[model samples]
Target: MASGAIAAGLPAHELAYRELKQRILYGEFKPGRPVTLQGIADELGVGLTPIRESVRRLIAERALEFHGNRRISLPQMTHARLEEIYTVRSKLEPELACRAAAHITKADIDHLEAIDGELDRAIAFGDVGAYLKHNFRFHRALYAPANSQVLLPIVESLWLQFGPSLRVVCGRYGTSGLSDQHKEIIKALRAANIGAVREAILRDIAQGCTFITDELFANENQP
Candidate 1:
């Protein structure tokens, strides 16, 4: 939390790492589309050595994979992978939300409501990027009260893996009919109802995961 850690003071590789992760988490890169390390270094405005080190960290995190011919990209989706993601998400996310409900404040609820408003607008306007970004913001804010060190990172790792595929799904079928459970989560949080928080999160995960699963398998041969 030192001032030195801000912006330029951070190491080049660390800066590149954060930037690259955000790009992946927000679906700026498509799954299975490999790009060169030097290309990433140029885009990130950092040296090749630093970018390669950053990418090595991300690859260890499973956010990126080495494609053939010395390139990297977001991992492609598979049915088995989707099934594992859904199982892990369904278990962790609802628990995180419910734990959050136990300590969530009015300020937290207000923050979530604000995010949901933008999310709703994104859905209405078919703004895929905004939808992905805001939806992530809303969930992260909702769970911040929990102050979780363990479960939260696991959930985020799941999102990093899941976000690109959700992007593909949102693009194929526009933002219409995406999950509306944020409203339910907000309502429950405002009411201070822990049970309702759990329920809403479960439905939200199930609804989104189900859509992704159905869409991913609709091809029967999709990887």
Candidate 2:
């Protein structure tokens, strides 16, 4: 009974963490934006204790940084850090996708297809926020069947770092081509072709690399 109660409480804690993390990652709380424990508690309608705990976890993850006394903000992205993250993701995500392809069901494909539709709608309406939301969901859905809870959180942390910069890229280059990758991924999954799925996932990540690489060079050449 005690274990059951503890298990039940986990989701609420995770809920607090995820909500706070998403806001930080998605640029709802921009870099250098101040985050107060009480403000988050009030915004989330939770107690100060849970909000404090969530903030501490994020700080540990390097998603939130503290400076001087009592000031916290989202971590700023740098070119070297972005390169390192994409390198790690380039190695892991494709393998996870291939593993997931082996176990994917029709329902999983259906859900992914629906998410693709949402991406399309977000693109059509020029809603960057919605596009990012659906894009994250679509990628998560692709790897859901892998049951890799261990690596998934690591992947999410990478996303936390990558997500805001992705917003910058989308704002500059537009996101119309992103949805097209989903079609290829889904086709590979439907055929249960692990190699093809892996290649498609790698291709997707590589495209982001190309964009970020160009952005990095552009920033260097500025001024």
Candidate 3:
């Protein structure tokens, strides 16, 4: 049990948690797909104890549902779930950006621009994984300076629930026109226009929620 051997000083159980969380967050695990503890243990080369602990945490987070026979699955999105997550995201993400506008420094803005460049490259290459990865990174970085102890975790929880389905959407539709709100967000940040930043984030949230619904729940609200 060498400390930092696996990933920058994280304990074995923590590393196991991250390995599993990344698979779910980045869309490697499809929605509603069940997986086995033994299989994950084999893949990650960790013991079942850590994997089971990680699964317990995910289950507690409501990101995974546990069943008998040593299986767990990422839940599929329901319309009610979609709208609620959207409602929270639309409201809170804007507030985060607005708060961030007050605190984001020049260096932070420069770093965000660099991440946006990577985002553009991901889109151009039609790499869904990269696009999702960088997209989340850009927003996380933008919101980091808000220094929110409470709101940030809530928002990230919302993302963990929605992120995998978004991967499914991107794969089905392709990343041809994923909205360049990051560009607008950067411009607004430069102008110091908090309102513009809020609006851009709201539009980004709406567009993303719409994509998931249109693709997965087209008949969702129909009679």
Candidate 4:
């Protein structure tokens, strides 16, 4: 199945939605930065009709916010929402990782290693965009081996909504300040320890939540 409703050569509406969604997912759209339909149309080389439709869909998903002036922007993170997201992820992702551990092959581990290496390079260069992209790729790689027909779509929607805010979090805490849990995940996978893999994934999610929640609180307290 398509990763999302949008892809190249899809009908105009879907094409627009997917391209716009990908940009939002990659943090190309900064939180609270107003995005006009025409502006997105210009950026994506499409028309305003498709942009308008896609923006509406994104708003319904809570991925984009429609403001008083009719401006649309990425939603800023809140403690409650962040907590809720982490809570769901804590429950779901570890389960998926555990399943992945059972089914993972040597090639899967090697692919994960390669992705993590790229992630490290992104962090080293302070390439926040690349870091976020590769981090998504790493998780997707880890879970794909599980062949989850049921959980994949739900997990993907969650990732789509969470992606932009994650970029902001990465900015607040640079690569040096971040913990690398993919290493532990890889080790547990190699050992074929399902429990260990689950724990490792839980730790990974919690570690990221810490960074984001800390930053959110810090910003909340600012004058």
Candidate 5:
């Protein structure tokens, strides 16, 4: 194949892997849903080899489960996994938020404010996808000042797991008025009050934890 075709086409396996991973992470493939290599290959118009490679990677990442005969399912969230992810976030995200508050520039703050406005619109329109996307960008912008490249991947992994649950929670409880926390965070950042910024972020994350925990417990009692 010519270099351009090679570049454009990409290896089928890599394409399959990326497409499958994105779907899973984005909650398009819900928890416990069966995902077969052949099914994925057919869906993506690829061959089995690439789909197999994709499945292997997801399994390694604990994002997918594989049974004896190549049967696979999206990984289900456990209380233990949630606790572990939350613990990591509790330690890292607040510190990052504090660092961001100290180092963020006016431009960064302005960008975040714009995103906050977008989030408010999403909430008003009940656009869950838009809300989630901009909400993620708002948090990412806050953490941008930290410059911790190594830590970002770990944080992003936690997000991949938590994102679906968050969607569910947002669906259950309408997201209107959620931009209040963003405003508080911006206020803390503007004042360069690292403590206030950290507290605000912690409170934001804690509220999410409370919701998820409540849902988990409620589900458990549904026998």
Candidate 6:
């Protein structure tokens, strides 16, 4: 069992799952890097049983890929797969943001702004980990106010799929080269313009798509 305040009451397997998922989300484990059950058990200070179960669940979630030989790794992004993800997000996410615009309170906007500030600082320092973490936080904070059970999980699943790839892009491009339309999102939200908010979300998605697509192209052209 892992000895930590957050894992105190949680079951060993659940704790392992949460920790593993977070590691993947934060790009601590790069895409296609093999992770062994024993290695994870040692790292988390838990037995292999719990770590194995946790890894199995992540595999089922498509967040981690099982490469036979008892090896597990984060999934690599492909051009086709990323295109599908962006297409879905380009539609669903903007709708979510539009809905959120109607119900957003000043406090919610304040929290989002704070998250953006953190995200900006992370970019300035070229901190890929902090940038990815805070970028997710900002979007989640924005969408949570919509209070939709169905859409939130769907959007999160998409994030789980592409997040590792985003980290790869950040590593390749450097934070200074990254682009974000989140400020446009904030401006639209503040103005209470639902159409503009939706457009901003679409633009954000488009920018991300362009970044990932460019990375994919560069990788393909490499000898």
Pick the TM-score winner.
Answer: 3
Tens digit of per-residue lDDT, candidate 5, span 1-223? 2243268787766766667755655556667767666776677776677678878877776777886566788667777888887898988899888776777899999999999999889999998778777878888888999888877667766777777776766777767634347888988888888888888888888777777777755677577
Quote the positional error of residue 112 for candidate 2 in Å: 0.7
Question: How accurate locally, in lDDT, is each candidate?
Answer: 0.87, 0.79, 0.88, 0.82, 0.76, 0.86
The residue-level lDDT of candidate 1 at 67 comes to 76
Residue-wise C-alpha lDDT for candidate 3, range 1-223, written one tens digit per residue: 3244344777777888877777788888888888899998888887889889989988877778898799988888898999999998998999999999999999999999999999899989999999999988999999999999999988887888999999998999889968758889999999999999999999889988988888889976789
TM values, all candidates: 0.92, 0.86, 0.93, 0.87, 0.80, 0.91
Number of residue pairs clashing in candidate 1, backbone atoms closer than 3 angstroms, sequence gap of 3 or more or interchain: 0
- Candidate 4 collision pairs: none
- TM-score-best of 2 and 5: 2
Q: Which lDDT tens digits does candidate 6 get at residues 1-223?
A: 4566244888889988888877787778888788888888898899888888998888877888887877888888787888899999998999899888899999999899999999999999999999999998989999998899999888887888888888888888889978888889998899998999988899888998888888766667678
Q: Which window of 10 residues has the lowest lDDT sum in candidate 6?
A: 1-10
Encode model 4's per-residue lDDT on 1-223: one tens digit a residue: 1323343447777877877778888888888888677777787777777778988888877788887555788877778888888898999999888888788899999999999999999988988999988998999999998899988767776777788877877777666777759999999888888888888899999988888788767667678
Q: How well is each residue in 1-223 modelled by candidate 2, as lDDT tens digits? A: 2243356676445678878887756657766567677777677877777766777898887788876455677777777888899899988898789778888999999999999999899998888788888888999998989999788888888888778777776777676654447888988888888888888888888887677667645767578
What TM-score number comes out for model 2? 0.86
When sorted by lDDT, best at the front, the candidate numbers are 3, 1, 6, 4, 2, 5
CA lDDT, candidate 4, residue 131: 90
Order the numbered candidates by TM-score, best leading.
3, 1, 6, 4, 2, 5
> Cα deviation in Å at residue 57, candidate 4?
3.2
- Where in model 5 is the C-alpha error above 4 Å? 1-22, 45-54, 172-180, 219-223
Judge candidate 4 at residue 39 and give its lDDT: 70
What shift in Å separates residue 104 of candidate 5 from its native position after superposition? 1.9
User: Global CA lDDT of candidate 2, please?
Assistant: 0.79
